[model samples]
Target: MPKAYSYLRFSTPEQAEGDSYRRQMAAALDWCKRKGVELDDKLRFHDLGKSGYTGANFTEGALGRFVDAVQAGEIERGSYLLIESWDRFSRQNAMTSTARLFDLATAGITVVTVDDGQEYSQERLTGPDVSPMLLLVVKLSQAHLESARKSNNVGKAWADKRERARAGEHKLTKRAPEWLSLEDGRFIERADRVEIVRRVFRETIDGYGRRTIVHRLNEEGIPNFRAGENRKRKPTGWHASSVAKILTNRAVIGDFFPGTGSTRFRTYQKEAEPIRGYYPAILDEDTYWRAQAVIASRRRVTDDDGRVVQRGAAGRRGSGVSHLLTGLGRCSICHGPMHIINKGPLPRGGLYFECDTARRRAGCDNMNRWRVDEIERRLLKHLTYIDADAILRGEASHGEFEKVESVKARLADAEKRRKNRAAMLEAVEDMDPDSLARYRELVADVTALKAELAGAEKALAQTAADPGLKARLAEAVDLNRAMGEAEGEERTAIRVRLAEQLRQLVEMVDFHPELSIIAHLKPRADVPADQVPFTYDSGNWRLELSSDSEPHGIDPDIFPEEDPDAVRAANAFFLKRRLAKAGGAS
Candidate 1:
């Protein structure tokens, strides 16, 4: 009897856990019985709900790990890799799929097609008058060809749907928000769910961030929106990213952009005209646009080099969003945002932060790290002690708009440069010796400049269009009272809610000499610099940044010297922060 193993994959969880899985298993067992092969149950690999079209199916999926085991000489040389059919192995085209089949053959493993009792071994695959490629072309089952062709055709269909959406001639036929339900093929907002949405929007506009909003909703025991049902899964919990999505959705403003993918996806457009009367809007235009601007501004942090810092991709997978302050730190010297570092899944799963520029060796010498857990605790403690009156009101400095004007000024500069380059190109002759090289450089420069200009213009437009949202956003936020009102775990949950409120009121924290943490109060973008009364400008910033550090600083009790690394990081950290007025700020 020969040794055998089985490989199984299903594209959807329903199929993986349903009759498809059972039928595939029966076929493999019957094949083993017929061939008198001893099937090793432990060697069976299951790529549950993993697609086979991508090479990842064999390279990085569970099947890939089996390949790794084979390479490690765990499986016997003549072991059989049993599967239902060719399509079950991979949905790739015949050429690529055959090549992967040949790889296993070369490794001395025989691939057995259980459905037909066909065995593919090294000798049978490579014989006289038989080029493996040509043989596969002639012999690949029609089922495999159809599967591959269908994948391509469906992609093209999605392309067609997207184009139709862009033309505003099509609307998504899939699931709408829970607040919206399809009644008689028209979208109608449920009054109950609409109230929930309104409360979410109001809290968001009035200084509540995503995580806090999620917590507030969960604490209220509200049911989250679900697209479908799954018996094996846990009940849906409101997620910060989900709340963030609701806040930023243009559909709330009566505008919708239908997007295409395997699943019907929706894209958000900042300046698109609303699809009039197609669906009732849950939020007025001003509030919708205002929510968008705030969300965009929070993600628009730039390093000293003027490159945007990317936030995590929707938190850590199934873990949902972490606390708000997780990625908000900066290295005062390198001027790049800090990124979280982890100790993997080893003995102690410790998480910390380090300067990105230094980590990448991009030339700044600010090597420092901070324990994330400790930092989160300190922030909570800091919020506990802060006075509510410190959050100054009555100024137009709703933090969303301050960052916009600076970006606009930069955009204006970009536009001017683009025009200058265009003019120079107009004067140059194509036949000239330096013309081609200059043209190429000018074209690339203009392209980059235009892209930057387009982004800045869009952001400025979003901010410009919404005075009403800003008014609502500028409503007095009392972080102290909000924190004080919480009784148990809710009090500690201030990490995100207070962080969101602080974003608009407080500009950023600058760590200064003697471990002093300076709170820079943001000024209104509309407030003129000459009238604002400040000696030094924080780089073209017009409004005065009142530092509140002398009163409310990082609590001394929370500070600790964990190790030599901590000491070194602390020293470098402060040295960078205490640099001269001309010194860089991350």
Candidate 2:
């Protein structure tokens, strides 16, 4: 005749899996059937693994949800709430329990305590002053006390367990860190996971960023640290944030903060002191801290929203500026990084690559800025002057076909020298009247000659087989085309690509007063960028353009003087640098 909603609750997972849930459900169902009340399964609400002592059930529990709906008039005023007992409705404090019951009764809905066989309604609860429901209040009060007692017992048991852990009886709880295995009341490093942690830290120290490491790990299909292996679940993958956590975790260093402290049940450990020697360390303290230092160093200065703002030229490549030479340009005098600054009405190649030192008030006499279009145009003309395309074509054929023979000849000569030296070294020894020092020197020379011969032979073999020349020639041809033929976005993309390529090719470009460019050639091979010996050898060439004596201070596009020889030298430098990078130049 009446609509009755069933409320099912399980305080613990064990209870959910046990007969308690079935018994509670059966009681509610049987009571409804006896009363001939229609009970729809849709109206059955379940809140499992929730504690009765906490009022979180009201906010998060199914019974509390039904009560909430009844109070909010979502349920009809005459609907019934069927619970196993008053205690099942709530095990809150005496006052709170009584207040909630009164509120429920006042809302004109009936609360059926099936186990206790008690029914509370608005009419029965009506009294002039207090709505004298002595029996219900007493029952609720008993339930509240029982909940408090059980909560204290649970807290005591937790304290006992933590004390046992503190007294070296067992680990703090059931499980330890994933990298650690709890064996016989002690934590030992899990070998496989330990290796994973070591790799993470090592990768971090090697300058691989967290996100990059994550991508690499995912690419390699390396599974992450997961507990439920052998259980039927999807495999978890690595993430940047998770990698970051692994990097920052101190537990990998074999120190574990057990988090055993003075607090209530399930509370945060306040004064945590890590217990060292709990497990074998995956990484030493020095390596761990070194990684931490680098990680700290890379953390950029961020705005309120965590977006990095460029303060100085520390790590800023000036991605905001779309100019081709923004990152590659360098101040000739001060050696500070050059940033792109747009001046004039703009788009007439008005973009200026100026030194950041002068702008930052780090007073420098060379406050000169180079124009983008002027530099690009000069650069192109310089490439044409050197006939770089022809040099590339010639170099390609010579490296592939011609140079191998010469390298072989040199290699043969070196091997002959090595053999002669080795023979001399063998003949000498202690038996000869010559000094031991002389014999040792001969041995060293033979060793050197042998190494040199090997290098020459390798070089000859590489020259004969290397296929890198075509790509280098193609890149150079593309640069020439972008400078001479292309326009608009196509030209811009090529220019930017060329700029990036040149960045890897040339070390830094130094601007002179007359729009003259001097790119202090950065080495392209194993040669270091700074110590690019000032040489005219095509293999390790440096660029130096002639400058007008005084500053012209006119438009950058306007050439101070048409020096064809200077242009050829500069273009040769560019082509040589590119070839050096391509590993096709001898």
Candidate 3:
């Protein structure tokens, strides 16, 4: 009996016909019985979903592996490689088909086509008579030509469908995920998930910083998309790249781009490519552009050489002081965070703050440093000058008073409108269509007004009636008084308060010894400098001669006389000496 291995393929839906896998297997089994061939179930191969026209690209499929096994002599020589027909075997390029035939003949394997009734083998090709071989090659080439034409037709149909979808015409493809669905032939967002997506976009646009936003979202218990049905996967934290993606996604704006291919050959094309817009947009184009602007305005920090340092690694030092300056101060040159360092030994350590930018970036002119003690002293003096009486007596500047008054007036107006709208709505039962419509308009206006009113009231309450204000002011007064008449822990508490308040107003504290200036002010440009009510420096405490002059009592000459090199050297020597002393005592 002949050893026979069946190779079966159905390239198209028309070819499948009533002859599916089960029918084809039965036919192949009957053919084996009729030919007196031993058909091994293990050797039976089928490429059901794979296309014979693209056989050259095949790998790991049943037909591909069968060809590989035959070449490797895994099957005995003279074994018959049975197939339904030449086209079912392959309709690949002419060169590929010819090469495969040559390989099968060289290996002593007999290629037998059930439908064509042609047998191919090395023994049958004596002296290149070639008539039978040429006929088979011509038939295979014709099959390949037909397959190419069909492929082109299919691709053109797909292109037409894609173009129509891009024009906002809906064509049913695959259904969306179970949690989402199409409405009015467009993707209508699920309110819950849509809100989360919108929030991600909003946070990215607001410049909360990617990590901060991620932290906030996770803190709020927002589940990530990939989390399983019952298992809620909250955002571990937002990465900057993730935030950037959310900000740039067109999906939020209600546009959908189809995947490049159907399920069998899916691909992702470039986002900017023309695509189907099958969904209603949740965000406007202007809003998306605004978010991009916010992302652009954020200033990222870098080292002295203009290289960015990872946020986690930057400002890792300083004994509980660095946190105070985290977002408040940055290196003027590198824009890196300033690190706080204590200059002297423990039990009497003198503190100073230096910009990480100057340390990391070579040749940065802004190697500014400030004595922490002097900053504290000057800040205390400035706090004393604030005149607690001025705030308590409502003698604060007109601008400050007006800010509070404006919020109050807005809140009152909103409440009044809400009341008037409520009265109008009550009379709507007796009104005609026009009156009812007018009443509804008033109701909407009142609802909006009341919402604004609530927000205004909250702002005013935070500014005017905040418990933190009185407590902070009292703490500032006590600290200022202690600086004049206390030592040790008492002074440290005062320094902490000064640092906190100063941070709220000061963007960065630059210490430029080269310029003989201890503090370089980058005040919030919106707030008047006079409103800050403090001068900063590394010197003896003094009230500002004028609201604008240096607040510390030390003359400007004092800073010029003190060399930064000397100060650093003194600090280093002091640290080493303290270390030696501790070692010796131990």
- Best candidate per TM-score, number? 1
**Which stretches in model 2 have alpha-carbon errors above 4 Å?**
127-132, 163-169, 215-228, 234-242, 255-280, 296-586
Q: Model 1 over residues 76-158: C-alpha lDDT tens digits?
A: 78999988877778777667778878888999999988887778889988877466546455555454668668877986786
Best-first order by TM-score: 1, 2, 3
Colliding residue pairs in candidate 1? 335-586, 397-524
- Considering every candidate listed, which one attains the maximal lDDT? 2
- Give the clashing residue pairs of candidate 2, or none: none
For model 1, where is the 10-residue window of minimal lDDT?
A: 264-273
C-alpha RMSD between model 1 and the true structure: 14.3
Q: In angstroms, what RMSD does candidate 2 have relative to the true structure? A: 22.1
Model 2: per-residue Cα lDDT over 347-447, one tens digit each? 65477877788888887666676677667554443322122332323222333222333333334434554555456557865554422443455456556
Q: After superposing candidate 3, which stretches have Cα over 4 Å from the reference? A: 10-19, 42-45, 56-60, 125-131, 169-180, 204-249, 258-260, 265-272, 276-278, 285-586
* Count of clashes in candidate 1: 2
